[model samples]
Target: MALLEVKNLGISFGGLRAVNNFNIQIQEGELYGLIGPNGAGKTTLFNLLTGVYKPGEGSIFLDGKNITSYKTIDVNKAGIARTFQNIRLFKQLSVLDNVKVGLHNQYHYSTLEGIFRLPRYFQIEKQMNEKAMELLKVFNLDGYSHYKASNLPYGQQRKLEIARALATNPKLLLLDEPAAGMNPNETAELMETIQFVQKEFHMTILLIEHDMKLVAGICEKLTVLNFGEVLISGKTSDVLNDPKVITAYLGE
Candidate 1:
């Protein structure tokens, strides 16, 4: 069975359809790309998959279980985690603390244990700290573990956001324009980091990005959306060279 599947997925805003008749099936450990011009409903699809927005029609399944009606937190708990187009980090929190926040859901201790500083609380907190540091190391942000998330440079902040999402231990990871606002060097490093994460974690990833170079470098399969509908879905190179996709998106 596919790790993530969406069939006939759609959503509307008032009188306008934002996403229409979308369908995809992602297999285990595959890297997929969803690309299009502005207003192509890319981010809307991410929102629907992550439970930020419920679909008006169609079903979403992860690991063969229906998650169409699941809440946001429940969706995360169901093994899907995502990073946003705009970096969202706790500005005032230390980098380590930010990752630990994602690890919070994994804590087995009760609220009472946490309130009383019981042994279970301390035990779980220590383990989470160790794991969070390990994740930071993967992004080369371990040195900044004690630094405030807001104090890091823009590129590092983006890495921190992805680290936090990884702490959730998701089977499926969705990234929305993860390389946005990055320079060439940073975007290059991010591509390597994403490749490492997928290999190390054995996770399925679907990304919505505008950088054709990055998408071509890493994505095994591609899907193009135009005006809220799919323009094409196939191998990355074929999708990139398709005249229809070029006319509608690449504009050449």
Candidate 2:
């Protein structure tokens, strides 16, 4: 069965249909791309998948269990995690602590235990620190683990956000325009990092990216959306070459 599947998904705002009849199946360990023009509801679709918005119709399944309208926290617990197009880190917290936030669901101690620094709290804290560090190292941010999250440069900030999302141990990782503010060098590095995530974690990733080069470089398949509807979906090369897409989206 597909690791992540959406059937007849849709949503609207008053009279505007923001997303309509969307459907897709993403297999485990596959890197999938979602692309479209601005205001094409790409991020809105992510919101629906992550349960930030309850769809007006249809269901979403992860690992074959329905999670259509699960709460955001519940969705994360159910194994879906995502990063925003606009980076959303805990600015005042240490980089390590920012990642620890993601690890919170997996590690636990009672409120009193945490407040009193009981043995269990320290034990769990240690394990979480170790795990958070490992995720930081994957993004090459371990050396700056003590710095405030707001202090990181833009590219590293992007990596930090992805690292935090990965800390959740998700079955499906959703990245919304992760390369949005990157330079060419940074975008190139991001391509490598995405491939690394796929191989090292055997992750299923669905990303919304406007950078065709990045999408073509790492994505195994592609889906195009226009005006909240699917235009086409197929192999990367085929979708990129479709005449309708070229004329309407690529403008080539």
Q: Candidate 1 — worst ten consecutive residues by lDDT sum? A: 243-252
Model 2 local distance difference test score: 0.94
Q: Using lDDT as the measure, which candidate wins?
A: 2
User: Which of the numbered candidates is closest to the native, going by highest TM-score?
Assistant: 2
TM-scores of the models, in the given order?
0.97, 0.98
- lDDT digits (tens) for residues 134-189 of candidate 1: 99999999999999999999999988988899999899999999999999999999
Model 1 residue 134 CA deviation (Å) reads 0.7
**What are the lDDT figures for the candidates, one per model?**
0.94, 0.94
Tell me how far the alpha carbon of residue 54 in candidate 2 is from the true structure, in angstroms, after superposition.
0.8
Error of 2 at 21 (Å): 1.0
In model 1, which regions exceed 4 Å deviation? Answer: 250-252
